[model samples]
Structures are given as C-alpha cells and as structure tokens.
Target: MPAIADRTDVYLERFNDALARFADEPTWLLERRKRAMERFLQLGVPSLKHEEYKYTDLSALADGQLLFATQLAGAEAALPSYAAGSSSDRATGAGPQVLGRIPRGARVQSLAEALRSQPDLVQRHLATIADCEDHALSAVNTAFFSDAVVITAERGAVLDEPIQLVFGDGPTGRLPRVLIVAGRNSAVQVVETYAGSGTYWRDAVTEIYAGQNARVDHYRAQVESLDAYHTGRLQASQERDSYVGSFSISFGAAVARNDIGTRLNGSGCECSLDGLYAVRGDQSVDHHTSIDHAMPHCNSHQLYKGVLDDRAKGVFNGKIFVRPDAQKTDAVQSNKNLLLSDESEVNTKPQLEIDANDVRCTHGATIGQLDSEAAFYLQSRGIGAGRARNLLTYAFAADALERIKFAPLREHFEALLLNRFASQES
Candidate 1:
C-alpha cells in the first residue's frame, strides 16, 4: 500500500482550469462541473479499503506519481481509418492509423465541436445518463474532463459502418469522455480505442443512450503504455425494446480498472456485455459491472474472461439488480479466468439481487489453470509443449473473440491476442 495524497487542492486547481477553458460553456454544464467538483472533493479517490476498488490500488495514480499530470494538448485531430495489420499509432509512435470506416450520414464530432454546433443535443444528454454519486472516478471525470467524442444516429437512420474514437495519452494525464446516442429505431456501432506512448493515468467516462427500439453496439480496446494506470467507467440507458451490446478488450496498462453499468429503463430492452483481458508480468486488470433491470421483461447477458500469467492479477465483480416491477426479467452472468502461472492470481465474484419472484436470474464464476490433460493431448500430437500451451490459452480466450459481430475488428483483436501469447512465450 502506498501513502495517500491530499488531492483536494489538486482537484480544486484542475476544476478551476477546466472552468477557465470552458468559460463559454453553458451555465448548466458549468454548474454541473461545480457540483461534480464538490462531489469529487467529498468522495476523494477510492482507496483499497473501498469495496468497489478493493482489488486495484490507485495510490500512485491519485498522487500523480505514476502519471505526468500533463494538460490536454487540444482537440484531437480526426484519426484516419486504421489500416489492417498496422500497430496503433500510439504504440508504434507512428502516424495516425485508421481501421473500419464510419457509415455515411452518421454524425461523429468532438464535444468541443458539438458544443458549438449541436449544443442542444449535447446539453440534453451529456452528464444526464450516468450516476455521479455512485463512483468517485465518475465524479472526478465529470469535474475535470476537458475533451470528448460524441456520436449520434438520427431517428430511423441505419448506419452500416462503425464510428471509431482514438485517444493517446501524453506526458501528463488525460481525462477523456465519450457520449453516444442512438435515436428511436436507429442502429449504429461505436468503437473506442485507448493507447499512449508514455506513462500516465487516464480517467475516462463513456455514456450511451439507446432510444426506443434503437440498436447500439459498443466496443473498447485498451492498449496503453505498460507502465500506465487506467481507470474508466461506462454507463448506458436503454428504452423500450432497445438493444445494446458491449465488447471490451484489455491487454495493456500496469493497473487497469473498468466499471460498466447499464440501466434497462424501459420494458423489453435487451443487452449483452462481454469482455476479454490478457494480463501478464505483474500487471493488474479489474472489471466491475452492474446491470439494473428497472422495468419488466428486460433481458441481459454478461460474460467476462481473463488470462493471467507471470504474477499478474485480475479481478471481476459483476452484479445484477432486479427491481420489484421487473417481473419476467431474464438475466445471466458469468466470469471465467485462466491462470497460466502458479504465481498469478484472480478474484472473481458474481452477484444477483432480485426483488421480483417471477424473474429468472443465474450467476456463476470459475477460476483455474489451463487444462493439463488438454495440453498433454495436444502435445502428444507432436506439437511442442510451449506451442500446445499457447494454443489452449488462445482457445480459452477465443470464445469471447468469436462473439464480436464485426469481422474486421475481430480480426484485429485476434492478431493482438496472438501477438500477446507469442510475446509471453518468449
């Protein structure tokens, strides 16, 4: 455990700086930031004693010892479509890269730009969907966030391509926010990519809103510096008959934590949350997810898997809450982990709180090493022992990969996963 720093003054400075930068921002947003700053001060950074953050420590991060505490450069230049087989620009220190193309008519704008052009749209949804009081990280992000990406689909519009938002950390830390809204009957996909060149702490928040009967697919890839500290929160609200799917891939960062929450505010909403993480070499990854079934007949499915090696650590805590009125709800949650090294550790917990007697809910968790029998069977086929082990490890993670509906994105992640396994073998 590291010593805790008094960040009250630090956050006060940050809040003042943000206010100065956004002096022209709407009064509502400014007031929100003021309130959020107060909340941040009151809550402070969560210590290991904090139940929600018990697994991943943030002392170094809170003190800005691990991060440079640098200021945001400016509005990020639009990233080019990522090219296949190319390393991320942040990883390679190369020029910008592009992957999948966004569909025509879909709107993707930086929050700064949105404020200028679509202030009403940004004002209506921004900071309105997420719970600021539940998490200190959320409050901090809300108070200090300076830049963000916003994407939207008009009512009844169908987007063929997914929108991608890429971010790279600088010498100092960065607080990036994302807002995505899908109008009634609209369909769209959003991909968020996080990477960096140097050690820094990144606190990010992404909020998604799905209108009645809308469909939204969300994905995130975290490949920051190996020495970086990353904490993020993702929240979503779905309307009647709406659908949302979230996919998360985490492979980098010395200390990484993700808090995901979804609220089924309307009946008949459906959601799927899936994640895969590969951590090695003393790194740590933590994921906490909550699905709130607030209305009747809402359905949710969640699965999170991880592979840890070389003294690495992983944590998963998943919770589902079914309100009294959420009758006939159907929910399933699972967390599975594979330990490749005896020294590695993983803590997994799955929880369900149901108030409706007629609702159906199931939760389960499993933690173990790679199957020795399966490895031996493969080795007997003339494959090298190391190769056999790697194959099985890849297969274990492939389940979540296969669930990705986007072919190009799936391939990209597969390549990264294979590269990760190969590196571990060496």
Candidate 2:
C-alpha cells in the first residue's frame, strides 16, 4: 500500500521544486502560493465523513491513486468531442468547439505568456478570487498549477462569442487555472473544455471578478474519459450593480466533483448559475454550489439538473447564505434529477442560511425518474426506444441550453448532442 502521508509530503516537496522553475511570478502571488501550500499541508484532504463530502468516498484518491501527477498521456491525442467518431453532448448540446464564444481580444494564452505580455492584468486578478486562506482546493491548485489561461473584456465591450479553455487528458495529472476579469460596463462569455485521450486526474480552478456594471457569461464543460477523475472549483466576486451568469455541464469522468461559490459584495449585483450533469456506465458525479449575499439589494438564482443511467451515481449540494446587512436580498436555488436505470441513483441537498429577516431565500432538491408517460408516448409514435430516449433527454435538457443566446453556438450544440447520443446508443 502507498504511504499516504509520506507520498503527500514528497509530492509537496517536488511541487516546491517545480515552482522554482516557474519563479517569474510577482512577489505577492508567490507569497500567496506559499500560504496556500501551507494550508494544504495543514488540511490534507477533508474526510468523506465531513458534512460536505459525506456521500462521496475520496479515500481512494488519497490512497496514492491521485497523488502522482503525471503528464498528458498522448501528446498528439485530439479532443474527445473532436475525435473522428465520438459524439458526447451534455446540457449545452454540441458545438464545433467545447465553448461557443472566443474572440481575439479575449486571450486564451498560457500563464507564462500572460505573465510576459499582460502582467498588470494578471497581477490585479490572478489570485484574488480564491484567496490562499479561503479554499483548500484553490490552494492545492496554486501549489500544482502547470499552466493556465487568462481572459479579460475591456470596458464597455460586449463580446458575442464565448471563449473556450481546454485541457486534455494525459498520463500525469493536471492542475489548470483560469482568471477572468470583466472591465466596468463590459460583457463577455467564457467556456472551459476538459477532454483528453486516456483516463487521468484533473483539478481545475477558476477565478472571476466582474467590475462594477459589467456583465460576464461563463460555462465549464467536463467530458473526460470514463476512467478519469475530475475536481473543480469556481470562485466569483461581483461588484456593485454588476451581473454574472454561469453554466456548468459534467458528462464524462469516472468520478467528478465541482465546488462553486459566488459572492455578491456590492449592492445591485446579480448572479445566475445554471448547470447540468449526465452520468452513464460506472461513473459518479457530484456538484456543490454556494451563493453568498453580503450586501443589500442583490439577487441570485441557481438551477441544477442531472441525468443518470446504468450504475451511474449523481450528487448535488447547494447553499445560499444571506448576511446580516444583506437586506432586501432575493435568492432561490433548486436541483432536479432524472434517473434512467434501476441501478442509477442520485442524492441532492439545498440549504439556506440567513441572518437577515428581510431577505427572501428559498431552496429545494428532487430526485425522480424520467417522465415514463412521455417516453411511452414517443415510442407509441414512430420513434424507437433509443431515439425516443434521446429526444426526451434533449427535451429535459433544452431549458438549460436555451439560456444561451448565441445563435451559432446553439446550432453547434444541437449537432454535437446527436453525436454524443449516438456514441452512448452504440
């Protein structure tokens, strides 16, 4: 058996050496990384018995299955969605690319490239969203971040196309981070796509800050291998009167988990989180989201949907916290699941923590099977079982896709959906 403590200590030591190789980061950023590494050492992986991770068993990862971060398995491997005969579309459907929008000015370069060309931008927002002291996952990512992408929208600019940040599967593990900052009055959309050739472990961290009066649209897509393991965390801080819209789709990993947190720190800020998770075979997927209202007059809404088949398992945990000063705040959260097989299962939890009596906050979660009546009706017509299931899956997921307004991206997602369904059917 692998010595968990010894292995983790040694990994941290090697990670330190790796940081020396990329020592060109700013002083403040480097110090922040140091702090995070300290925390990771302090709070090793939280136990499954922990209130937040109760349903999932992550001990296997700590048992040395996840400690050794390897390199990309096939250097020349293509994206799964882009693979010649593979089609796997989730809630957002399918598109030519994983993310629907990406413009030239939106910048999708590596961390080193950004450090050299756009130092100030990186300096302003890189490690701010996920402070070293706040989240352990962010700290872990900071200690191991191999490479990353940085996106920013200039003041007053509205980009129609969303940006895609992709990382492929490999022999080794991955630590990918993305930093997005929307200048005041600007509008932009960003898509993050994770797909690789073989089964691998992936840890993705994203930080987003929307300036006062800005509008930023975002989506995170995970379509890794059936044997792959994935963990992600998205942290956002919105300014006064700003708006942030986020969507996430999880369809592929053997074991996948996501942690998302949004903060409305300024009055009049608004946030919307829309997400979908689909599982099949022996896969398991989990999502945890939090919305914090810290100021007055802010608004937020969260909707998460899940589809499971075979022996797949799904989990959703959502929470909304309204602070004492956050009067007149409006928040709502809901989670819904569609179980397709007798062996499939799902666990969902939605909670609210309020300190302000004037705030309106509500949350709920539901687990159920697909509408059999609808499926039977489709079969009663000319549609076969597989096609009927596909049609109904599309219908169940269509609402989330409709949230996106980009015409070209929408069409691409539809075509992509057909391909994913085809692979599953085959």
Using TM-score as the measure, which candidate wins?
1
Put down candidate 1 lDDT per residue, 80-160, tens digits, no spaces. 234223442321122123344446556666666778877998888888777687687888888777666677788988987
Compute the lDDT of residue 57 as modeled in candidate 2: 68
In candidate 1, stretches whose alpha carbon ends up further than 4 angstroms from where it belongs are: 1-5, 65-100, 170-173, 419-426
Off by over 4 Å in 2: 1-4, 63-69, 75-109, 116-120, 132-134, 169-173, 406-426
lDDT of 2 by residue, 127-224 (tens): 77777575556677887676666777777878876655556643223777888888898888876767765656677889999999999888777877
What do the candidate models score in CA lDDT, each in turn? 0.79, 0.75
Q: What TM-score would you give candidate 1 relative to the actual structure? A: 0.90
| Top candidate, metric lDDT | 1
Error of 1 at 100 (Å): 4.6
